[model samples]
Target chain A: MPLLEIRNVTRRFGDFVAVDNISLSIESGEFFTLLGPSGCGKTTILRMIAGFDLPDAGQILLDGQDLAGTPPEKRPVRTVFQSYALFPHMTVAQNVAFPLKMARCSADETRQRLGEALEQVHLTDKAPAYPHELSGGQKQRVALARGLVNRPSILLLDEPLGALDAKLREEMQIELINLQRDVGVTFIFVTHAQVEALALSHRIAVMREGRVEQVDEPARLYAFPKSRFVADFIGHINLLDAQVLEATHGHLRLTIAGLGEMIAPPLAGAAPGGKGTFAIRPEQVRIGIHGEVTELKNHFPGEVTHFLYRGDVTVYKVRLANGMMIEALLPNSAPGGAELFKVGDPVRVGWRHDAGVFLHE
Target chain B: MSDEHANLSPAARLTKWLVSGPPFVFLLLFFVAPSIIMVVASFRYPGEFGGLAPVAAADPATLQGLTLETYRFFFSDFIYTEIFIKSFFVALATTVICLVMAYPLALLIARSPKKSRDLMVLLVILPFASNFLIRVYAWMILLGPQAALSQLVNGVLGAVGAGPVHLLFSPFAVLIAMVYVHLPFMVLPLYTNLEKHDPSLLDAAQDLGANAWRRFWHVTFPLSLPGIFSGSTLVFIPVLGMFAIPDILGGTGDMLIGNLIKEQFLGTRDWPFGSTLSIMLTLAVLLCVWLAARVGSTRGRYA
Candidate 1:
């Protein structure tokens, strides 16, 4: 049985529906993330799971028991807020020891657990300091310590690293994953950044407009998104409008508008003559000097419009004869990669048959 | 290269000094000088004809020289001592009451939608425009022996059957007048402090595992301490020196320190005694301010 189950939970505020009939089952010891833009209701769903809010419809089950009308204090869950809500007037030690104090635990045990929690976050040296005395990253670590000291069944994180700079954010991400592994508790984190979600989550739920767009592992969500929205939202994907020329025996040929015929693996359960969209990641499309000929499948001829020099990869924008533009990412290590692609140069862009996925419009 | 020198012209220097000097001079002449004269008056001898006399005049009727007799008389008299304590207790009560009532109101005003908050602020400030003496007189008719409020309170308490009830000329009436007269002072500072608070802090608290009461005790109450201190000081300091409400509503039933001081200065013609009492009251206000500053700094150190 799953440790936490949200069954068709919906939250509405007056005339606006913030969470629309979302159902999720989180297994024990999993790092789950709700990824979406602002106002997408991902935070609202997390609040419902934390018992800070009640669902307008449906049920929330924790440990196989229904949680209805339960206040946040009564729940066996905790949240590390985006602001790192450390009690401003309390020292770091007192803030970490709050949950235990509220639970009426023995003073010695509270002190011991507080010490362990602060040590886990490497903030024990500054335990007597106040929240305003700490840096942003340190405050977040203190918030993490306070949330985890309660030993809750699930730990909810609402954009925990949204306030940090880039270098600190990367460091904290590793710390968070390690902390989760050490504690071995289910975590439900919310964020709008795709890279952070992809880096941290065991399973991710992509949300848009108050609905779950897709839920899958990071690799699957990146490789084969089911919808145009998810494909466009996840990463840089070149979407081309195409017509299904033929479909047979798990192999399909698509005639993309403005670009010539490209044959690829057939989409599951899609019929011939049906219009669909083809999504291919920029890195999957290769730019070579002399590779693809007619017999080679899923190849196109184009001219490079511009090249962007990224640290690890060189990105080329290729324009076909029919005015369809495609982006191709070539690694910096490729032979002649740095000097080869420039403005107005004829380029051959090709990909494997399995690279591009046919997505429903 | 010489922008600083170019900016520091004579007219600019004169303008800056001109703008800042008037207020200091005004304070020196109007406020500091009078205070110094009053302190000096506390030591001088009172003449037989009631004007201040040089100590060498040697009036036989009044005290001859700079004596501690006036201060001694005030401290030794049982009635004046009781009245001073009575005034201190009343001011303390008013401060506590104002804090309790103003905190939630300030929070509400801080959080209310803009239109409603503006309307409410206007309502809070409207009472201050009217004359305080006129308001106290209005309360007289309402709190009279035969008034409906007195009769209703007495009826509920089972003290009076159904007829007229007398709550006038009592300490209760004095307290009621103090609260009514000084409510705006309490609300304004409390509202200002609460308004300056960043609401994201509260949302941050709720997103954490804190329940409502914990959220307020740990987050809201501590942040609102400045307002509490300011409001309490504003209400308490002024109420301690108030004589109008006590004299009008209390009559002879309850005489506070302000009334006693007024009697010494004007009624009993004792300027030295009144000046000494005024100095003590000033010291008391200073002590209250010191306590407030201490609490504010302690909260700031933690927060």
Candidate 2:
């Protein structure tokens, strides 16, 4: 059984529904992330699981027990706030020891666990320092130690690294993953940055407009998005309007507007003559000339309209013969990779038969 | 004009100093000159009739009058010492009462929605619109024996065979007036501090298994110490030397240090003794401020 289950939870603030009928089941020891833009209710759902917010319509079950009216202090879950809200008047040791003290642990055990928790975050030297005396990264580590001091069954992180610089944020992300693994606790991390969510989470739940758009592993959620929203939100994906012209046993033909007809692998629930969106990542589209190779099944002759050098990859904007513009990311591995594509150059962009997926509108 | 200030020549800096010279001269003329006169008068002898003795540096007999006799008189007198001690207790009581009443009120205003918080803060300051003496007179009427509040209290006490209560000419009346007049001083600082607090700290405390009471004790109260220090100092210093509240509501025996100073200055017409008492009171206020700063800094070192 899953350790935490949210069953159709809906929370509304007056007329605005923040979390609209959201349901999730997080297994034990899973690093699950709720990824969305601001005001998308991902934080609201996490608050409901933490018992800071009570769901208006549904039940939240922790360890198979209903947590409908349980207060946050009584619940077996803890949260590391985005602000890293360390008690400013308390030293780092006292801040980390607060939860254990609240739990009525013995003095010896409290001290021992506090020392261990600080050591886990590598903040033993900072135990004597106050929260104001520490840096942003050190404050976050202290918050993490405080959150984990009680050995909660689940730890909820609400954009805990949002306040740090890019380099420190990346370092803390890896440190958080390692800490989560060492503690062996279930983590429900929330973030709006898709890169951080994809890098840290075992499974990512893409949220949009107070609803879960998709929940899958990082690789699959990026490779095969089920909707245009998820495809556009998770990463850079070109969503082309297409209609299924023919569906056979193993191949499905699509007629993309402004682009020629193409045959690809069959998609479930896709019927002939039905309109949908064809989603393909920029890196998946291989750019070449027409005479270079002819074995590919889905190839389009286009003109390179623009090119951007991104250090590791050069992205080229290719406009097809039918006037459909698509982005193609070519790795700058070879010496001539970046120079190969220039503005107004004729280029042929092709992809494998199974590179793109059919997405519902 | 902008190009003129952009140059950093010595003449421009002199112009800047000339532009800012009037306020310093004004302070020296009005404030510093009077304080120097008061300090000099406190060391001189009282005149035959009243006021300070004339300065006489030529004759040794008249120069012998520049003595510490007024300070000696103050220390040797028991009545003045008792009044000083009594005034300290009254100020302490008033400060405690004001803080107890203001903290929850300030917290409520800080936690309220923005629109209602503005309304509440306006209500806190609205009492200042009226004349302070008139407000104290209003309290005097409410606490009088024949007033409705006292009559009601008497009615409750009369059931138990007790006589009608007298509240107007008592320390309780003075305390009530002091607290009512000074409550805003306590609330405004506390409200500023509490409103500026990051509310997520409470949520983080609650998330860390702290219940409501623990959250307040560990997170809310300690974070508000600066406001507490400021509010206490604001209430304590002024309340210590306040003369009007005691004069209006207090009985004949309830003279505070302000009343004593007033008696020395106006009643006896002894400006030097009055200046000495005023200097002592100023020193006491400065001592309170110094103690408060010491305590505040020590507490804030960890915070």
Candidate 3:
């Protein structure tokens, strides 16, 4: 059994549904992420799991026990807020020791736990300083230490690193993963940044419009999204509107408007002669000079409409004969590698079988 | 025109002063002139009949006529000292009571929805629409021995074999009127400060395992200290020098420093002694404000 199970929970505020019927199971010690844009109910779900909010319908179970009416303080879950919510009046040590103090732990035990928690976040030396004296990164670490000091069964983080700069955020992400691994506690994280979700989560549940669009491991979700919204949301993907020409046992042949016909791997629930969308990641497509793509399964002659040089990689927007625009990304292996393709240069773009996914939406 | 005023030349400075001259001259004429007169009068001897003796123009001996006798009389008299102490105690009591009553009401208004919060603040200020003296007199009727409130209390006491209690003409009546009159001063500052506080801080405290009481003790109360300090100072300073409340509600034996000053100035016609008392009251108020500011700063450093 999973460590936490949310069974068809729904929460409504007046006429608006903030969290629709959402069900999820989180395994022990798993790094789970709720990824969505703002107002997509990701934070609401995290709050509900932390017992700060109660669902209007259905139940939340922790260790097979129903948590229907447990208050946040009584629940065995701690949350790291987005603002880092350090008590401005308390010292770092005092903030971290708060939960233990509330539980009426022995003084020695509280001190020992606070020390260890601060050490885990590498902020032990700054224990006597107040929250106002710390930088944004240090404040975030203090908040993390405070949340972890309680040794809760599950930790809920609502965009805790959203306040940090890009470099500091990347550094903290690695530290967070290591800390979670050492503690071996289930972490339910929430974030709007897909890159952060992809880098840190063991499993991600992508949400939209008060509903979970898809839940899968990062790689599988990025490679084989089940819906057009999920495929577009997870990463950069070029979607082409197409019609299914043939659907036999485990294969599909699709004809995209202005682009040539292509065969897709088997996709469940797709009918013959039905409208669908063909999705492919930019990195999956290869760009070559004209007449140099013979080995690939699908090839099309195209002209480079625009190219962007992005230091480590370059992206090229290619237009085929039928006016369908496709994107291809190539690694900048050598200096000025993107100079190989100028605007209006004739090129052939190709992809192997299984590189693209077919979605009916 | 604004650009011209921003320059630091003498012409600009003169122009700036000229533009703002009326209010400054008015302050000097009304406030500074009277304070200077009071300071001069506090050092002079009282005339044989009343008030201060007029100093002769261009008479060098007039400077030597000033003496410290009024200040000496103020310190040497036990009645004056007792009145000062009693006034301080009454002001302190009024401040504490107002704080206790205003805090919860301010928190309620601060946490209320936007439209209701506006209405609550309006209600808090609505009592000021009436005259201050009239409001105190209204309390007089309510706390009188034959009033409904006093009769009800007397009924309760009579059930336990006690006689009718004297409710008015006592310190209790004075305290009730003082608290009622000064309560809005305490609540407004508190509400303003608490309204600006972030609600997420409470949620954060709760998320960290703090219950309602702990959340308030650990988060809300400490954060609202500025409000408390301001509210206390606002209530304490005005109530300290308030003469009307005690005069209307208090008995003959319950005279505060304000009434003593009034007696010296108007009843006894001792202008020098009255000026000395006024200066002492002003200094005391300044000292209290300074002390409150020092304490507020020390606590504010952490937040």
**Candidate lDDT (C-alpha), each:** 0.85, 0.90, 0.90
Model 1: runs farther than 4 Å from truth?
A291-296, B1-19, B55-80, B153-166, B195-211
Over A14-108, each residue of candidate 3 has an lDDT whose tens digit, in order, gives: 99898999999999999999999999999989889888788999899999999987888889998889998888878899899989988899989
Against the true structure, candidate 2 reaches a TM-score of 0.94
Each prediction's fraction of true contacts recovered? 0.41, 0.89, 0.80
Listed per prediction, chain B TM-scores read 0.89, 0.90, 0.90
Model 2 Cα displacement at A219 (Å)? 1.0
What are the per-residue Cα lDDT tens digits for candidate 2 across B107-194?
Answer: 9999999989999999999999999989999998999888999999889999999987788988989999999999999999999999
Error of 3 at B144 (Å): 2.7
Interface RMSD of each: 2.7, 1.2, 1.2
Ranking by lDDT: 2, 3, 1
- Candidate 2, residues A1-361: lDDT per residue as tens digits? 8999989889999999999999999999999999999999999999898888888898999989999879999999999999998888889999999998889999999989998999999999999899989999999999999999999999999999999999999999899889989999999999999999999999999998899999999998998788899899988988789999888778789998777888777887778888988888999888888654346889988899999999999999998887878999989996578989779998888888877888655
Give per-residue CA lDDT, model 1, range A180-293, as digits (tens): 999998999999999999999999999998999999999999998999988998989999998888888867788887777887777877777788898999988877657443
Off by over 4 Å in 3: A245-252, A268-274, A334-336, B1-33, B55-64
Cα-based lDDT at residue B176, candidate 1: 86
Give the range of the ten consecutive residues with the poorest summed lDDT in model 1 chain A: A288-297
Residue-level lDDT for B113 in candidate 1: 84
Q: Model 2: chain B TM-score vs. truth?
A: 0.90
What's the TM-score of candidate 3 when only chain A is evaluated? 0.96
